[model samples]
Target: MGKKKSKPAPLPQSLALPYTGVESHAHLDLPPFSSDIEEVLKRAKESGVRYICNVFLGHEAWKNNRHLFEQHDEVFFILGTHPSHVDQCTDAELGAMRAAFAEDSRLRGIGEIGLDYYWDHFPRENQKDIFIKQLHLAKELNTRVIIHSRDAAEDTIDVLETEGFVDYPVLWHCFGGDAELAERIVKNGWYLSIPGTVTYPKNEEAREALKVIPLDRMLIETDCPYLTPVPYRGKRNEPAYTVFTAECVAKELGIDTEELWTTCGNNAIRFFGL
Candidate 1:
């Protein structure tokens, strides 16, 4: 008899939560997905990713692509100037961003705004200034904040504290900090987003950090088109790959996958007020 075809394993499922699964951070509006955004979204939906928080790099990017989000109700935005692009932003641009935040109901927070000392392309002072400005704007609008800190953890924490953002809901996206920093973040009531890098063998530090985070205070994301996880490391990442990152985090915490998924999904919803 001919060999029979085998069915693929079922995708892991999470308990019914307010959200379908959440991609806490991504750049879906980038050029990488411009040609096939619909297919990308379809893959995300099939993988159970119902909500995505897209971070806008700058005012021009937001203005040109904000309409793309309007077509997808599940997609949300975090409008702000990324630290790497701080040099390009001007006072007028910042004012426009403030106005957009006030007018756009889809903007859940101000974010992907923080220190990135790894790249010396722009002066550190400029990055900090823009970051603090956005933090103030977030406070003014009563919105949540998403932070992107790379090689500038201590500075990032200091800025947040100095700006009086400690009391507000903050999401430390793509957290690559050590266990100590993770503890400090959770202690301050901030959420740490586990990225696909956790799936990499060399990212043992991130995995250890994940162990210290309580499920309720933990979130998972692909940080798509960047930190593509294992089995797909060399390719472009998309929202659908968030499942792989979630599975890794669940394994690290020694819990069932569904529990991690539900907890993280609910965490995103509550943090973003979705």
Candidate 2:
């Protein structure tokens, strides 16, 4: 008879941290969580995640699916056109987002916006143009700005600098670079949203980079339905997994896990104004 295959470990529930951790970024409105969002939110709350910032990739996504979290007050919103989808952006869509923000008290930020060179799915110039437009919108509305930069760090920073975003309330989301990059981001007076990718075994640079990131300047996230942390790395990610990322980050920084968790959580809450 063939031997039985081992089952994956169950979701973590014993981190013992207080209900103070915030999932700084996530995409719970995506299809992966469509069937189990209620359970996912419950698990997240049980894992001590106080709030979750659910990112809507663009105006249509926000318009169509913003109702998913209506019953869950702990979930907030960040709306913007992602780099890959910049081709779909139009003036009317931008205007709609502005109107929604004015009408929705839960709309806390304008983001998941920036350059994405990895896919090259859209024209880089167009991406930069839409990115600047959104940045200006964030400024006009005076809301938090969350950035999604991948393989386009230099241009991202350059555009932000040129747009007078230096020393502004910007968050470099899903940071996957070295300590040097971490230093540069914080040096520009911006925050870094560390995702579950940091928990991977081979990402030594990220682990080492955590040493230089100040406690108050970093936040944790699942970026889910993607970047699930180790032990749960191959599984579909959810907001409940933020604690595992926090655990890994705390160990690298040589601090108490609970302390690091709470500090990062507080940093997220204050930064996103949740």
Candidate 3:
């Protein structure tokens, strides 16, 4: 008799959404699994996270993934060229983004659109141009913004100040700056989004930065498919893992996780204008 074949090992449930809450931010477009977005989302909802703010940072996925937001009532999206993609963008592309966003109520904000000097591929001036343009568009639309700043915090803050966005709801997503920067940002009344990077043992700067962020201004994210939290580190992250980041944050504040979750969830609702 032929030997029986064992069934394929079950895929990890980490990508599945938990049943408890919502996820603040995730890049659902990148993957070894973008092709199976529906299945991934099904797992996400089954896991408990009821909604996700899917950030688009350029790719074929951006063009094709619009349907995912429409197909699922629980999903929302943001559009903009990422700092790294600034060089590849043209004026026409920016115009297109403005048009698309102007037409879609679900396309909530302009984002993933701050500065990064981490690599030299894109010139500083080019990143600034695109960043400022998108910021202006967001301001005109009276929409929220998701800023992506890495190694260019001062320049990023300068742009915001120059643009007179003193009252706009700007979220410094995946904030990893030191306490001083956090203090400055908090003074400006801007918000900070804590990612799984906050859970890493080596991110002392981010851990310290958390001290300055008041509870009302705090938001949570996974920046998923990257920055997976501990115990699940080196794995793909999803909304369910937001709870872990929330736990780390609560521990930092000496508050209970339930209180943190409720507060952060409320912050998210208000910031996203949901």
- Each model's TM-score, in the order given? 0.91, 0.97, 0.88
lDDT top scorer: 2
Global lDDT of each candidate = 0.83, 0.91, 0.79
Tens-place lDDT digits, model 3, residues 152-180: 99999999999987757988888877899
RMSD of 2: 1.5
Candidates ranked, most accurate by lDDT first: 2, 1, 3
lDDT, model 3, position 174: 86
lDDT of 2 at 80: 91
Question: Can you write out model 2's per-residue Cα lDDT over 174-229, one digit (the tens) per residue?
Answer: 99899999999999999999999999999999999988888899999989999999
Using TM-score, rank the candidates from best to worst: 2, 1, 3
Return the top candidate by TM-score.
Answer: 2
Task: Please report how far candidate 2 places residue 181 from its true position, in Å.
Answer: 0.6
Off by more than 4 A, model 1: 1-19
The digit string of per-residue lDDT tens for model 1 on 113-209 reads 8999988568888888888888888888888888989899999999998888775799999988789999989877799898899989988898988
